[model samples]
Target: MYGFIWRHLPGNPWVKALISVVLVLAAVYVLFQYVFPWAEPLLPFNDVTVNDQ
Candidate 1:
């Protein structure tokens, strides 16, 4: 899959590296800004407790 993406990126090594970095940052930004927030309420992270019951 990575090889496929690398082949499709239209540039030499330096340009390809730059594009890959930008794409990764964009993905991270979108996930943190939208996806995680939307999913947070549906997850059980806040329900965790350390009780000796």
Candidate 2:
């Protein structure tokens, strides 16, 4: 998958690297701004409990 993206990106290696970094940052921003917030309530990570016995 990464190979596919790397192949499709235009320009020399340095340009490709810069675009890759931008794409990654954009993806991370989207996830934190939208995806994670939407999914957080459905996930079980916060439903913590302890057995006192």
- Model 1: per-residue Cα lDDT over 7-28, one tens digit each: 9998899999999999999999
* lDDT tens digits by residue: candidate 2, 1-53: 99999999999999999999999999999999999999999999979999999
Per-model C-alpha lDDT, please?
Answer: 0.96, 0.98
The prediction achieving the highest TM-score against the true structure is 1
Report model 1's TM-score to 2 decimal places. Answer: 0.89
Instruction: Give the number of colliding residue pairs in candidate 2.
Output: 0
Consecutive 10-residue window with the lowest summed lDDT within model 1 = 44-53
Per lDDT, the best of the predicted structures is 2
| Model 2 accuracy (lDDT, Cα) | 0.98
